[model samples]
Target: MVGSENEARITAAEFRGGAGTAAWRVTATGPQAVFRAVSLTQAASLVGPAVEAAERLGILADIDVRPEGVIVCVPDRDFGGISAAAIAFSASVSTAAASLGLEPDPARIQSVGIYVAQHSATDARPFFAAALGYEDLGDGDAVDPLRRGPQLAFNPITGDVPRRGRTHFDVSVPADQAEARVAAALAAGGRLADDSHAPAWWSLASPDNHGVDIAAWSDDVGD
Candidate 1:
């Protein structure tokens, strides 16, 4: 959901991880922040429970939403399949105290995502993506999308890159809470991609070729 549409910005995103239940570092703008979660939650997981509990306060005021695209990254080892992960929601702000079921300070939240892996022939597919946040890049408390930008190209283990250039972010949620997040996005009028719509691994293995495809929320849908 990333492009200049109706004066609104749409951006596609995804995530990656080396192991299960790992602490994920999500870069939003600048000064990257980190979160912990698993990697088994299905791409189609965050569609029910989260939505039932969270609510929208205003237009683009409480969620992260983006367009659909592809994200490619080199793995530590070769595998039979691929899996792409993403967080879907509108470009909005969320209060941890208001949206999440748990009790946290009602601070602004950027539509953030975690990373996923590819193991099976059907793993290299993107579900949806989003980044939730409050202030723009000016505020120190807010994430600087350009500063904490996604790793466009880099080596998996050493994080070494041959050439420095713009690259897509590899962000996805842990498998454990994938469903809950998806449900929240949907309830906010967001949707995740069906596994069936995913493409084959061979179709998207080039290191230089990476992207993330997320569904954006329309005015009516988000409302």
Candidate 2:
């Protein structure tokens, strides 16, 4: 995780219509193996940056644009380093900043956090590690999925709650390890939420009350 001194935090992207948190907001209810990027421009403009970032990360697979947001899908393969999630997050952040006429600091993105209405800060760690194969960095303060990008962090609500945002995790795993991953998730701090992995994915709900999706990439969505 990037230190506080080196980090600049920005939660979800807000739009011109005052549609707050619409930038990186997940639009659905179940565990989904995709990154959500909503905008007024049919999700294409929103995903433009992600395409660039994914290529830079060398995990370029393909993307799907829904009316509400764009789904940055990763193929069921490796690209030397990490892949989708971070690229999607960073790309969305950058796009949002650009839309708002502000500059996004890539070097300062410490971690992407989950907004929990109520929960212990430490509760999210084990589930993320066991479910999504994220490494517990700083015990519970941050988790490193390593495959995608950025660290996953916890964000407990303080005062007024705006919108109940969904915690998104587009986890990538091997076909053989799929069941074990599901087992670990349940045993640690997560419970099975959905079987979106269908032909190849598993979705789990964490103790911190967030959804985690463990999946291999697919190219059939926008093809």
lDDT values of the candidates? 0.24, 0.43
- Cα error of candidate 1 at position 41, Å: 35
Off by over 4 Å in 1: 1-147, 153-170, 197-223
Query: For residues 96-154, could you state the per-residue lDDT of candidate 2 as single tens digits?
Result: 54674433221111112343233432355566567766665543434444335435655
Candidate 2 weakest ten by summed lDDT: 23-32
How many backbone collisions does model 1 have? 67
State the lDDT of candidate 1 residue by residue for 117-204, as single tens digits: 3222321112211243222322112233332332222112234343333223333332333344445545665444343432210111
* Model 2 whole-model lDDT (C-alpha atoms): 0.43
Which one is best on TM-score? 2
**Per-prediction backbone clash count:** 67, 3
